[model samples]
Target: MTKLILICCLITALVIRINGHRSSIFAAAPAPSAPAAGDIVADTCKRAAAGDPDLDYNFCKSLLQSAPGSHKADLRGLAVISINLAKNNAQRVLGHIRNLIGEETNNTYRKECLKTCKEVYADAVGELKDSAKSIDSGRIHDARTALSASFDAAGTCEDSFSDGNIPSPLAADDDYYQNIGRIALSLAALLDN
Candidate 1:
């Protein structure tokens, strides 16, 4: 009788543990629905204008679904998208540099940066396809380098931006500065390896 009771208790405990683990896994999973269109659009627009390739490409796609006859908004969206895409592609060269640093074989951070770079690059290139010759490659390169540096700089960059210590027009270009700040932060994170 005692053996039977012990067996049942063990099984019950095992079942409860399994159920708890399952619930925690499910809780961690993200919902299937896409992000809200408005939030995506606003965030993308703001980021792009400010020169943030990561956020710019992320939100840019949703802006395409904006209501018809909103040509002004569309044009603004196109401009931001184009600029960010250019910056994204330019950053790829930096990714290669990052990969070659030390013996870190994981490359997860490099992958994340490149993923963002590709998305923004694709969007910008697509939008500017008609007037590709007008785009300034040098400016794009500068923006990308700045972004990479910003990531390496991390908290200092964030503090500068938050405290308005950086120049006004430059500060207004948050995307550009933020990306550079992020690159500095990423580099800092990589230092642990």
Candidate 2:
């Protein structure tokens, strides 16, 4: 009888210890404290840059902090800002693509690649617009989907040139836009978490 009681007590103690450790392991997230002005951008950019290999921490911080109300923006606002940054970059690249196409009247193949790049940037701009609207409407999944579609433009544009064994006229632009896309996507991911 004493042995039985000892065994039960041991089992109870083990179960209690396991449950206590488990609860500690699964503790709720810490509360968000109010940070000083600009900390939100700094903090979110740091986290986003840490998570994304292509995202430059300095670039991310500068881009986010430059927004009109960045010091006051929450994660969702940062998402919006990042999307806007990418969209603006796409638009600028479109103009650069047009200029390159105009300058390359003889290289039909390079011109073709430029045209494809232009199409992709145009599509990306529209997709980014939809992404912003989706975000505004609280459709996070759709926003991410459209944002991803937009993000593909940079790589797709670069790949078109690579397939033809030609140098990409927009190589630098592609790299720039790719980093912007990574930043935007990373910030959006934070909103989900």
Q: Highest lDDT: which candidate?
A: 2
After TM-score superposition, what is the CA distance of residue 161 in candidate 1 from its true location, in Å? 42
Give per-residue CA lDDT, model 1, range 30-106, as digits (tens): 65786544554454345443553444443344433343332433333334344344344335433432443333357
**Strongest candidate by TM-score:** 2
Which pairs clash (backbone N, Cα, C closer than 3 Å) in model 2? Answer: none
RMSD of each: 20.6, 12.0
Error of 1 at 183 (Å): 25
Residue 178's lDDT within candidate 2 is 85
What would the TM-score be for candidate 2 when compared with the true structure? 0.80
lDDT of 2 by residue, 24-54 (tens): 3334675567777888888998999888877
What ranges in model 1 sit over 4 Å off? Answer: 1-16, 19-33, 51-129, 132-193
CA lDDT of 149 in candidate 1?
39
